[model samples]
Target: MLVIRGLGSQYGRISVLRSVNLVIGRHQLIALVGANGAGKTTLLRTISGVQKASSGQIEFDGKDITQLRADKRVKIGICHAPEGRHVFGPLSVEDNLHLGAYSRADKAEIAADLERNYAMFPVLKQKARLPAGTLSGGQQQMLAIARALMGRPRLLLLDEPSMGLAPLLVEEIFNAVTELRKRKITILLVEQNANAALAIADQAYVMETGEIVLSGSGKELLGNERVREAYLGI
Candidate 1:
């Protein structure tokens, strides 16, 4: 449902993503695994239109969106849950979620999706009236993902969803992601946890120094000698 060809981006003169190419079929979970500086997050940001592309093309479904405005991209069904859990500190948890649906005008569907998000993260429902900053780290992460869902995204870009969470919370978050894919959400997952990301991904890519180094089935990459030694520490 999404295609990126020869994608390149930079932070001023410093290049971050170079000649990157990737595709995500409908309802597929595509995991992108790489080290901290491999430019996984930059690739996602460029796709979501938050960061401008220095070169190359980004197409969603079919049309080119390389130069689309960030908010327009969200309206076109590209939603990003960024690296940090940047929730509105003073807003109520429910309000933050409501803000996600600001681009849409379907009140009935928005309300229904609100319940769906609440069901997805019961903690958010319990803390509906509380300030988002009051929630625990794990809960805040849940809120971030749930808020993104409120936008009714077709292609969800999740970056470091499990960063800093406890092991159990990490498991919970991954399980929730799996559930999301099962419901036909196409996802581009950028994760530091190689093992977990590869295990759940339908397809996976390995990036090094701003370019794709390997692309294969998730299990194939999981068992690769180089991948095992470098990312998995096996």
Candidate 2:
């Protein structure tokens, strides 16, 4: 469903992503795992059109979106749940979700999707009237994911969904991600928790110094010697 070839990006003169190539099939969950400075987040930002690529191309469903603006990318069904769970602090929970569908004109479908998100994250429904900043970190992450779902995205870009949550809450978040895949929502997850991420992904990629060093099925990477030593610490 998505193809990236020779993609490169930089901040001023310093390069962050270097010739990164990847392909994601429909209905698949792909994980990208790497250390803190490996440029994983930069790749996702570039793909989502928030950060411009210095070189190479990005195609979604066979059409080039490299030059498209971020809002235009949203209209084409690309939604990103950023690493920090940057929910609108002053907005009510419901209003925050409603903002996700800002590009769409279908009220009925949007309402239906809103209910679907509430079903997925019941706490969000419970906090419907509260300010988003009042929620706990885990709840805020759920709110972020649910808000992205409100956009009815075809391919969801998740950046560190489990970053600051407790272990049990991390499990809950991963389970929710699995459910999204069961619903056939394609995902490209950038995670620091290699074990948890690979355990749920269908395919996984290892990134080092802004380049893809290895790619394989999730199970394969989980058992890989280098992966275990470096990322998994096993």
Candidate 3:
């Protein structure tokens, strides 16, 4: 559904991503795992059109979108749930979710999707009128993902969804991700938790110093000696 070829990005003269190539087939969950500075988030930002590519190509369903604006990309079915659950602090939970579908005019579908999101995160329904900032970290993350789903994204980009949550919350978030993939939402998950990410991914890529070092089936990378020693701490 998406293809990135020889993609590169930089912050002024400092290069952050170099020749990054990846593909996400329809209905697949692809994980990008690396250390803190490995540029996984940069790659996602570039693909989502928030970070401009210094070089290379980004194609979605056969059309080039390398130069498309961020909002345009979202309208084209690319939605990003950023690292920090940057929910609108003063907005009610329901209001925050409604903003996700601001690009669409289909009120009936939007209402149905809102209910779907509420069903996915029952706490959201309970806190429908509460300020987003009042929710716990885990609940905020749930709201973030739920908000993105409100866009009816064809390709969801998730960066560090489990970042600071408790173990149980992390499990809940990951399980929700798995369910999304099962429902055939194509996802590109950028995670620091290598073992957990690889465990759930249909495919996985290992990145180092702004370059992808290895690509394989998730289980294959999970059992790899180098991956075990470096990322998994095995």
The lDDT per prediction is 0.95, 0.95, 0.95
Candidate 1 clashing pairs, residues 3+ apart or interchain? none
Candidate 2 lDDT, tens digit per residue, 19-84? 999999999999999999999999999998999999999999999999999999998899999999
Candidate 1, position 75, lDDT:
99
- The total number of steric clashes, by the backbone 3 Å criterion, in model 1 comes to 0
How does model 2 fare in lDDT?
0.95
RMSD of each: 0.6, 0.7, 0.7
Candidate 2 clashes between residue pairs 3 or more apart in a chain or in different chains: none
Q: What is the Å distance of residue 69 in model 1 from its true position?
A: 0.3
Question: For candidate 1, lDDT tens digit of each residue in 1-234?
Answer: 888999999999999999999989999999999999999999999998999999999999899999999999999999999888899989999999998898999999999999998998998999999999999999999999998999999999999999999999999999999999989999999999999999999999999999999999999999999999999999
Mind giving the per-residue lDDT tens digits that candidate 3 earns over 1-234?
999999999999999999999989999999999999999999989988889999999999999999999999999999999989899999999999999998999999999999988888899999999999999999999999999999999999999999999999999999899999989999999998999999999999998999999999999999999999999999
Poorest lDDT segment (10 consecutive residues) of candidate 1 = 80-89
Model 3 residue 60 CA deviation in Å: 0.5
Runs in model 3 lying further than 4 Å from the true structure: none
